[model samples]
Target chain A: MSIIIDEKTKLAVSGLTGREGSFHGLRNKAYGTDLVAGVTPGKGGQDVEGTPVFDTIKEAVDEAGANTSMIFVPARFAAPAINEAIDSGVETVIAITEGIPVLDMLATYWKAKEAGVRLIGPNCPGVLSPGKANVGIIPDSFFDPGPIGVVSKSGTLTYQIGNELKQAGTGNSSIVGIGGDPIVGSDFIDILKLYEADPDTELIVMVGEIGGDAEERAAEFIAAEITKPVVAYIAGFTAPPGKQMGHAGAIISGSSGTAQAKKDALEAKGVRVGESPTETAAIAVETLRG
Target chain B: MDLLEYQGKQLFAKHGIAVPSGEVADNVDDAIAAAERIGYPCAIKAQVLIGGRGKAGGVKIAKDVDEARQYASDIIGMDITGPHGEGPFRVDSVWIEGGSDIAEEYYASIILDRGEKKLLAMVSAQGGMDIEAVASANPADLTKVHIDPTKPFDAAAARSIVESAGLAEDALDEAADVLAKLAEVAREEDATLIEVNPLIVTADRNVVALDAKVTIDGNSLFRHEDLAEIADTVDDPQEQMAKEKGLTYVKLDGNVGILANGAGLCMSTLDVVAQAGGAPANFLDAGGGSKAEAIVNALEVIKSDSKVTAILFNIFGGITRCDEIAKGIVTASGQIDLDLPLVVRLDGTNFEEGLAILAEANLPNLHQEKTMLDAARRVVELAGGAS
Candidate 1:
């Protein structure tokens, strides 16, 4: 039992004909995911890695019953692609493309929320439901099906933590990459809600970096409502003030996005704080064992 | 990228926004000519990127051409200390504008409220005052109009915002019209931010854009020729070098240098190093699938930094391929005479293969961590962290 995806989850690629879409589609198909169809405007009637392609998300969803979409469209086309996916009624949309203008994302995010669609990322590594069905760019060979769930703002950090968890003989219910964009579709709280509800998820590992009030907001939500034992690591401790450190959102502008602030907020809520991604998995294992 | 007042005004003029007739000059001769062209009673503004020029004596009202030259000479080549360190602050250029008596100063901005899916246009009657002061004290003075791209900028909504800004009947309509036009400009220019510090209402009963500053989205620059031409390449030396090498590098003034593949792990590397009581000097993310040359380029940028006391290599390979990173790391170690310690944390696809390369190279001060923790702790210790 995974948090956001499972074997039965129907999937499609929004930019099926693009390099990343084709690459991931083939890999996902090989991994036994139900890659029923794909959406590439003007590229209908084609097939990628044995998955049928349609020009629009609606056509693909209608013909192939795709319930989830992994968008590989370019930045300029990302908003519209996500909009099309939302309108097509895909319950879960994973956006793999990065660098979508903040304004475009603001508009698209609202439209998705209005349509009742859950978006994992517009610049994320996507979500993996362990040994069952993986929808993101994470290497499936590293994951093993188990009880711990992981949520992270950065994609490769998720992999690093997951690797440590696998080494510690702890598997995951699911690992969701919420993305590092300043204006991401889903955030810490949304994924935390899913992790909390999953019966298989016993312990959770949250990896967050600087920038924005998402971590602070998530800490507030965790302290007041969440009952699951959570082990967290807030990255960007050394990040300098004023200069935005690469990731669209990673900046130590004020008190809210600093590592100390996040650590203090989470610790006050009784969540164990790990010194690093590897330590995060270690702490999660210890917490779950306790 | 932050633009100076002179640059901002130039952009405003280009956008067809009404601004006081102005000219920018770099020296006293240029300043005298500029003042003469604009006539007497002009405003000579310093072209420093930092704000609050008026209070800092960076801005002065010149009653005549002689005063303009005096102000220009005082400002040009003058060093003003910032909250940070001081540099040879060039007057760069001085903006000489036709002076006008302002009836009221106001503030307006078009910004992306990411948390809220809207293009927020915020207006305040209290402008010339620092925005921070306004936000902290008279928060209510700021009125916001959320523009939905799906819908046109509503004049009725604009008027309501204008009224909320406490504008009088004579100025309300003009202010509202300017607000709508500014919003249009913001959208049309693909601007991430557009700030008019003092949207002025002149004594002549006219609304004028006194100052304009804008930040265009870098990702959308492929669509804008003018913006691309104006890209400020004067960034951190390391970043500038990295940009030349086709690698993404963000310079942070810290002692420990972090070179990693994938944005996620790069962030984690930063986190762990900090957790261990060390500061990462920069964020150099060599995207997944980077080759040895790319890795070498990233390392060069970090190693060139005199402040970098240690280097932390955190790579969790997927499509990036750990083997490629390892080869790159080895190549980098051989190419550069790194004075500091090197700590590596590598995992995933061909992890053992990558480790073998590093182990075989056996570079001096190069340490390997089986896990991210060991790498971070080792780097912290190497960085001279007491803890």
Candidate 2:
């Protein structure tokens, strides 16, 4: 019932022979995710954490019945790996590789869109269907299967906000990290559409930061379509203008990307604006409780 | 990743675009020689990575070799206070260019604007600080066209843009040509920004690029060796070291060192620290899946920063296993004899283990907080932030 990944979704790890790929694959197994198979070009016959490794994504999908893939390839090889996953008919692909060149990502994004595949991130923590399957780098300890659907631009902020939400007794239905890159595979509206349609997701916790017009676009979408009660937190309020705080794409260039502007836009759309992570959770809990 | 004027010209030249003949000089002798070779009436420009150099006396028009030499001696190695005087004002080099008296000034740039997913090429007929003023006062004066990567730079589209921008007949054709060429250069170099501050039309009505500044994406630099070779040597020493370790590091003017797991949390940490009345010295994200070695290296980088009086460890578990971060932090605490205060804010999966590791280490002035606000307050107080 969750947005991107859920209880029934089967997943595989690309580049599973690599260090990060293997570690995450093993952790997925620890959390009881349906880790069907692993894919590494040269090390097909190898196994990482009891998951069988195949040379190609097509072969892995065929043998293990994997529909989704978590790519841990390095930035240089990430675009090709995701392309392989998408071309092989993986319904959803989560790219955990950071530092991917924007050009490569653009091509990959267009291709994924053309192929009708759901692409999550190239520099993000990925998606988590709490207590069921954890896809990206988000900490699982902060999540519980509740009624609130949480989506964030930054991966760690999702966890930070999730911890606060849990402390406030507001469990999460799903948590999606759309990533902080300017050209991420998925946009806020993409996940918002999914969360709005999901029956399990009663309320939404949206965390946006100073960057892009993604928040503005989301505000427009929420104003027109979203019926769910949404509580949002816009990060980097005190940050200077025209400077990137940390994420490569997280720079506040003009009036639109500023935190204050985002909050104002969301508020105009009837979205409860949380000034801090703690406040965001508090408001989300109240909204869900009501 | 802002480029100095000289570096920008180098990028423009690589694209076969016409620019004033110029050379970057480090001293007055080199400046005089370059000016003499280019002839008198040259522009001596201070090569700092910031703007407003002209108003700040970083730019000067030298009518003779003596004036060029004087400007080179004065502007080169001169300190320039940027707008608001927030610094980044070191002057290590100067560009001496054959100057041109402009009949008109225009503005043009190719930047990957986030509001649009594609490369955006913006043009304005007004320039020379007037362009900035125009953008601020009347933004409609700026005509922008988003370049579609699916298609080549359309000359017709560029011509339309020129017409829409209210360029004169000859200037329209010439400006359109320049835009097409710049778009090509931007694609080939994989640049994030290519700004021609003053696209000057001389008295003879020839459109010439008065200055060039290109910011290429650091991740895509593998494609362009020439652009990649312009590695900034004057970057902060701590940032340079962090870059070598494959970590994302940015040095800020604040005093509290912030080390966080994800980019979002890292930014929020800066905000929360600021809200707690503490200014963060730097913004550092150890990525989400940093191992012990990477965290240790990041901590070492933070320790080396002289401005950092305290360290804030804001970890949110999950993919960046708290236990692993804890081990790294504990090891970092012992590896480098830290003299500053440290606050650990750990949450999410395996957080208890991470906390256990920190508690076992028991370093002086090391403490853990249950809430982000509490953690921030504690570290800010230690680092002299108000209650």
Q: Give the candidate number with the greatest DockQ.
A: 2
Please list the residue runs of candidate 2 whose C-alpha ends up more than 4 Å from where it truly belongs after superposition. A44-50, A61-64, A241-243, A254-256, B78-88, B130-132, B135-140, B154-157, B385-387
Pairs in clash, predicted candidate 2: A137-B319, A138-B318, A139-B318
Candidate 2 per-residue C-alpha lDDT over A47-139 given as tens digits, one digit per residue, 9 for 90 to 100:
876789999999988889999999999888888999999999789999988778876777788789889999998788878888788886666
Query: Which residue runs of candidate 1 sit more than 4 Å off their true CA positions?
Result: A252-256, A264-272, B14-16, B26-29, B65-67, B77-93, B148-150, B275-279, B333-341, B377-387
* Reference contacts preserved by each model: 0.55, 0.64
What is the lDDT, from 0 to 100, of the residue A248 in candidate 2?
Answer: 71
The single-chain TM-score for chain B of candidate 2 is 0.92
Candidate 2: residue B73 Cα off by (Å)? 3.7
For all candidates in order, the CA lDDT equals 0.80, 0.82
Which 10 consecutive positions of candidate 1 chain B have the poorest summed lDDT? B81-90
Query: DockQ for each of the predicted structures, in order?
Result: 0.54, 0.57
lDDT of 2 by residue, B259-309 (tens): 987778888888888888899888898976678998889989998878778
In model 2 chain A, the worst 10-residue window by lDDT is A247-256
